[model samples]
Target: MSCDAIGSRLTARDIGWGPNAAHTLIEKVSFSLDAGDRLAIVGPNGAGKTTLLRCLYRGLVPTTGSVYVDDEDIHALPARKVAQKIGVVLQEMPADFPFTVKDVVLMGRIPWRVGLAGWTDADRQQADHALEHLNLQHLSSRTFSTLSGGEKQRVLIARALAQQPQIIILDEPTNHLDIRHQLEIVDLLSSLKLTVIATLHDINLAADFATKAALMQDGRMSAFGPARTVFTEDRLSGTFGVKVRKRPEVTSGFTFSLAAS
Candidate 1:
């Protein structure tokens, strides 16, 4: 699938969110994403990565500025319409819903439904394809709450894929998983043709998988650009408050390690 066919150009302009003038979780964050760009938002805890993502996905309305999808203001669009264009896999999971894995995945089709009726055959096919894509086909009939953390994460990703959105936003998609699973999840994301924006804690993974990277600090965008340009030792050390150094590569890809204090 080409980006022109499945992706939406996403832009956030001067976005800020806070309850009052005295407090702002994120401010003056702006970036534009073209089709096929995989952008990673990287920051330490309390750096507003998740908050910014929430604003983009319409989970939280920005207190200032706007987010546009394909040149349309996202806030002005209907919630269902926004949901159709942007698929999100959040960091938190639901509190033990009784639905099976397939049932939960089928919920992705709710935005497309025209009436109060149950899912149609087309919805089932889409859900099934998503399940297979995420390697969750064998677990379709399993209870959602019974799955392990990695399984649960894949299920949520399957649900997002079932939505068939133009863009996908993931908040820490690799959280709570082992190293192998983390690599697997990131690898799967790299293979997708859709526009992807994610918050990644792993700097190495961001360097390898993200075409663009944004560094956030104290509610501000410190840097945003191509991953290679933004992931340098000076920038990484400054943003993270650690002495970082690029390790000598024994392999093809770049790697970094913290220098001793």
Candidate 2:
């Protein structure tokens, strides 16, 4: 099935999160995302990329500011309502589950199901469709714990797709995939029409997959704009504390590397 066009507009305004004023994890970060936009949040470790994503998906509340979905305060909405609007796939997975792959993916439909009812036919169909879209139909009956890292990642993505959310937030989507799977997953995400917000570690992958890039440093936004414009050598080097250089080839797309000091 084609992606539904329920893409939402997400906005963050001067958001700050932390236990106390002296230890802010994310501060004064603001950005806007329109429908059909793919945004890549890139930064080094401890740059608060994950923390910002937590705020966007309402997993963690901001201490000082707000996140809005299509002008509605996300924190004001019910958690189930927020789940209906935004789907999230985090980097970590639960340690153990005795359920089959299909069963795991079907959990995504929880937000849509009525009170205390078993899986309906429509929910099963949606789960099946999501499995097929991710090419996991053949493994639908296999135990989720037996799958490889990349397979688990794909299963999580299939779950998010089954959620049928307006906005999808993925933290380190390509974390443990092999190079080929990484490219394939990134390419697949690029084809979707929904609003996507992902934190990517690979600069080249971010450059290829995202329309816009938000560079974060020390819990603050260092730059936010078109990927090509924001991922310059100077900005990358400054944020990552490494020398960077961009190389353009005749046939291949732009490639980046750490320059020799």
Candidate 3:
């Protein structure tokens, strides 16, 4: 099916895959994402969380079922068209390249550009807006390799936003940040009002930003629903094999917790 038929920003049905392995990495995974919804995906290490994101981001095709973006089958759409609508910030970025922060972020706009022509004013404007959104305006001219780990992560996020996609997928985006920056990124994404799908090891942060949550284990979905329902002590403990406590937030309309999984 074409992406335009679903009217959802992202969708997956019965997606599964495994190569020369005993079991499939992901199995019968089906989900749909409406525009502007935030979904936090939680799973143990090797639970196929990263692999699932890869499939959605068009990095790997599923061995069965299908992935759709805005009603178009991801496999059917051109890569450039897919890039324009779905931006991704991965867990780790490639190193050894000497591009500047601005240079790296601007790469997001390549899909919209033609030939080897110079970047247009609108391109610079979009890149600048993204940098500003991440509060990295001052570091635009800095070399990407010279930045700290957290800074590089934010820059990659900026690059994703520069694409002006309808949805953004972040895989362990907060893996290397201090507490303050981690909270900042979560807050920023929450306020952007875009469809966001994130795989986070930090349950508290996920609960803080997500409107909905999905728990995965053993290559299958364990549970998924509103944050309030999914983050309960019982549900969390059962999934992670840990003790957890949920505390409501005074400002935000959500809760935070510590899981002893």
Scored by TM-score, the top model is 2
Model 3 TM: 0.89
| Residues 1-261, model 2: lDDT tens digits | 334555889999999898787999999999999888999999999999999999999999999889999999999999999998898999998657788999999999999999999999888998998898888999999999999878888898889988888899999999878998899889978977889999999988898999889999999998998888998878888888777767756221344456667
After superposing all C-alphas onto the true structure, candidate 1 shows an RMSD in angstroms of 2.2
How well does candidate 2 score on lDDT at residue 41?
97
Stretches of model 1 off by over 4 angstroms after superposition: 1-5, 250-261
The per-residue C-alpha lDDT of model 2 at residue 166 equals: 88
| Ranking according to lDDT, highest score first | 1, 2, 3
- Candidate 2 clashes between residue pairs 3 or more apart in a chain or in different chains: none
Residue pairs with clashing backbones, model 3: 2-71, 2-72, 3-70, 3-71, 3-72, 4-71, 4-72
Which should have the higher TM-score, number 1 or number 2?
Answer: 2
The per-residue C-alpha lDDT of model 2 at residue 243 equals 74
Q: Is candidate 2 or candidate 3 better by lDDT?
A: 2
Candidate 2: 10-residue stretch with minimal lDDT = 248-257
True-vs-predicted CA distance for residue 136, candidate 2, Å: 1.1
What RMSD, rounded to one decimal, does every model reach?
Answer: 2.2, 1.9, 4.2
TM-score of every candidate: 0.94, 0.94, 0.89
